[model samples]
Target: MARSTILIADNSCMIRKGLRSILQNLENSEVIQLIDNKEDVCGIVHKRKPDILIINPDMLPGDCLDVKRELFNENKLSLILLSNRKNLKNDLKADGYINYMDGQNTILDMMQEILNKNNKSSFPNKNSETISSREKNILKHIALGLTNKEIADQLFISIHTVVTHRKNITQKLGIKSVSGLTVYAILHNLISMDEVK
Candidate 1:
């Protein structure tokens, strides 16, 4: 099996240290670099050509979508944008997003899901289907063990709509049980594992 190269770009030393500590546990993971600038991201990515690139959304130049497109046009490199704000979730342009607050195990699972894949093309792309913000909100509630009626009330939607959204989320992500969806939510940064019940 080939070893994985991961590049982490964050302005905070603490954040970089935390992620490196978690990611280093993966067997055969190698050549990890913690960078502190947005301008250097493209240069490093071009030079190192890491298998996976983890970066803070705030550290990216201009709109993240544009930066993702320009810097990650190669399908072999998977990009993950990390953020703590719920509202920062954008359309599924990058491979995915990770909440910086996730537990160590959840972070490991998310990265392994990308790295252990047989082919890089299996990673999420611009054309891949994504869960809507409303669906993501409902998913968070469901993961917290809320009833469909309770979720509907909380989101100001009908119970039937809540069911429909759940079904859509299931179909898009191919995850059925509440636990599976909870893991999915954590992996996608729709909700942190700490927020799950």
Candidate 2:
């Protein structure tokens, strides 16, 4: 079985080394590298393409936000932010974030969580955002396995309108895949499985 790789990025080599040691000890995880140069992050990621990158948000060089985008957008790397502060009351949209604490935030827990996530993808939807009437209609139509064109015709709209509605629905619901949307639609009684099939 292939082991999962974690790439660590921080300004301090000491911090990186410590994290590297902990992560390498975690079951089913291998440390790809523990490096400090922020400039190296994007290049290394493009080359090695580790499954996840553990990066210190404060120690970033240049535009870390852009780096996050480039890594995720261009290189397709998942990011896990390492923060030293507690009580992150505000919403920050990273794949995950960890404060450098001792207790059950152990390397073992991190590894298990990541691997579990790999096998069974989970989306944390705490908000349960209310869908607009139009998005809900689009989802219902999709659940019925109607083509966008069919939905447009049924709803007396253009195919582009149906497509636009779908985009809005997924965004509002934070659902990225068809199966996720379908399951949600069924759970909400928007449509039946038989209808989709």
Candidate 3:
């Protein structure tokens, strides 16, 4: 598995240090770049090509929207905007947002969430095959100890439909047993450990 590289582009010393501290603790994390220069972030991202780029929209040089558009156009690196405000504007249109008002835990959680979604090896299929919403709900239902009949009833589908979905889920996930599926659901945050009982 290739190590994941993360770049932090915030001019603020405090925010940079905080992000670095939080990111270094993640597994498979390789390089965490803390940008001291407040230049064109998109150019830096194009040059470095880090797995993820966390930047403050307010700190971007020139038009923030233009930079965001340029970064979006590049499409190689994932963009995560960091904001000190509680309510973020809809204009920046970043892939992810971390609000400073939500505190340190929120930053860490958001970063981890983005990394999880973007990390290829995080899933059974190397994150190649996207799990449909219906499949995810079915997986959750199976993990919660619901039988095919019960699931069908809850989902308003036929028992045969539930069985077919179960077969497809097993084939896609490579998890045959209900226990294995339960563990997968828990690890992927589809269901919580507390909800297992």
Candidate 4:
């Protein structure tokens, strides 16, 4: 089997380097791209077309959610958006927010999980008024502080879709701000205090 290509996007060179090393060590993984410039992530994804894209939520510029969708447009690349552990249960990040008790280990684990899924392109159905699986996946990233672009890359959805999820989530829950959604997620058991705090 061909080694899986990995893309790293972050504003910090040191962080990107560290992630690059980790991915390099994986048996089927290779760091095919590294992006420290926010302006370049979208363009890079379009050009390189890696199998998996790992991004830091805070690193991307402009409505982070928008970036998520942009990357998902032409490919089925899996995403690994680093996020705080508290985010899994709550909030409405544009997308690409994944909670990790241990950011590094969690990322590796998530990658393994995706591989287990064999890069299946099936996402949560889009019908119904309640939060769909795709929305839930993105919300998990938001609570973790992932930006829109990060979420898009992670979920393989469009930035527009990530934004749509955020809007729909807020409308259904009657919440807007991140803090408010975080709190609602916690209070309603959508997420736990441990995850929120």
Best by TM-score: 1
Q: Point out where model 4 deviates above 4 Å.
A: 64-67, 88-104, 119-197
Residues 6-112 of candidate 2: C-alpha lDDT, one tens digit per residue: 88888877778877766655676688787677678767777888878888876555544455675557654567777776753143456667777754456567657
Q: Across residues 164-189, which tens digit of lDDT does each residue of candidate 3 receive?
A: 88877887787899999999999999
Best by lDDT: 1
Model 1, residue 34: C-alpha shift (Å): 0.8
lDDT, candidate 3, equals 0.78
Give Cα distance to truth, residue 166, candidate 4, Å: 52
Residue ranges of candidate 2 with Cα displaced over 4 Å: 59-67, 87-91, 104-107, 121-197
TM-score of each: 0.56, 0.52, 0.55, 0.50
- Candidates arranged by lDDT, highest first: 1, 3, 2, 4
Error in Å for residue 194 of model 4 = 71
Pairs with backbone N, CA or C atoms under 3 Å apart (clashes), candidate 1: none
RMSD of candidates 1 onward, in order: 17.7, 10.9, 12.1, 20.9
